[model samples]
Target: MNSTYANGTVHRYEEIKFVPPSNNHKTEVQSKDVTILPNKNVSARLYLSKISRKNKKFPLFFYIHGGGFCIESTFSSGYDSYLHKLTAQANVLVVSINYRLAPVHPIPAYYDDSWDVMNWDARGKEPWLKQHANFSRVFLAGDSAGANIANNIMVRASEESHFVLSLVGMALLDPYFGNGKPDVLWTYLCPKTNGIDDPRFNLAAHPKILSKLKCSKIFVFTAGKDNLRDRTWTYYETMKKIGWKGELGIKETEGEGHVFHM
Candidate 1:
């Protein structure tokens, strides 16, 4: 599908149509793209992959891709690589979600779509999840804007106890709002009215919701030069202050920008 840029230019954003290149560590795994109807006829593509194993039930890693909440797909090269690595190293089922974009759908639309997919998967209501996912050991992960969605999903799930997502680990890569001080470059690059501080995107507005997250291990990766460094740090601090019994891993890489997580 194509999208219209802020400059009123319509750009073609191609759907993920190619098989990812195979890696040395992983066997050519089973992969398929399926559509899930979250609300009425509104649907999003869910990319599911499995690494063959003998007896042990592997952990589940659900990943969300980053594109400033408006671009990219689950099959982007960087995300595809990351999933391959996670599967090779952890030997877990990796599922990447393609949420609805903004501008056309706007804030909360992405959140809603994410929540619907997550809830469906967590409840084993989705056929793919029932067949492939091992619910006992689960992890939530995301990068850039996708990191924001991952965090929000955890918060919402914990607050309402909507679905029993027994997530033991979480990995957030350079999480930030589009309007924070560090996000000045992003604002200049793609100016928009509703951003990080907006009530819709503001994580602070739902403190109660976030307080419910009780993960055992939280790993955060951020670059020193990234605009969202401060925000990511603050989030890390907040999670600790809220009594989250988890270990934090902050890697400060030099010369890496926002998309480095990819």
Candidate 2:
């Protein structure tokens, strides 16, 4: 499939095979193994790369990889490619997290770990942060289930005025929610449990939190064929109705399905 960007540049989707990170070697980007002490110790990892040192303060982009809250990790090449692209394009410090997964950790556990990492990063103020990671210009970007976690963090950050006071933008890649749709279809289609009413996956349940978020820019990318397409649009409309003064970029990828961004 092909899509034309605002710059009039045409881009085509090609099949790209990824090799998972091996124990023996590391990619060009150096990742540090760290455990977030959130209430209980949360097992997590951070991928770090310094883009530039000329600027005293650089923007930080926290990324959450998507896999239906069950199967993907920050080490996956699909996520690695996304991080590399962001590092080259934005000149910001990108950290991809491996939060605890579902069916084992369940709902709120993922949200908890995400918030924990955000808080951990907030307290540490990494050295690169002084030279490259901008504490005031942070952005949250994620895909699929990761997008759900990112949105939750944004809500929590706004509510508690925690670590994300500097959040200026958010990019949700195909967020999944029910939006009052028939549960039967969602249950039949999705491999995981289709508990659309679950606070983690349901956006309407957190209207107050969503309203409190002060993001100036929001980008939601969804494929026309995705079941979650309507939910993404609904959330965008909800943000507008709640008087969020932000620019929303809703791009519908033609002839693509869910997880197309990955």
Q: Which 10 consecutive residues of model 1 have the lowest summed lDDT?
A: 40-49
Residue-pair clashes per prediction, in order, are 0, 2
The collision pairs in model 2 are 58-132, 58-134
Per-residue lDDT of candidate 2, residues 1-262 (tens digit): 3444678564545443544532213334544555566545564444455433456455778888877666677766787666665665565667677787554555667788888788778765655444556678889988887898898888777667445448999999998665865664334333364466555566765566577777788898899899788889888877777776677778889999998756
lDDT of each: 0.66, 0.69
The 10-residue segment of model 2 with minimum total lDDT is 21-30
For model 1, residues 1-262, the per-residue Cα lDDT tens digits are 4556778675657555434434343454545555667353343334344434443355778888887776777766666666666666566667778777655665667778878777767777666567767787888888888888888777676667546778787888887543344454344333454554553355554445456676767788889788777777777666666765567667768888886755
Q: What TM-score would each prediction reach against the true structure?
A: 0.77, 0.77
Model 1, position 47, has a per-residue lDDT of 38
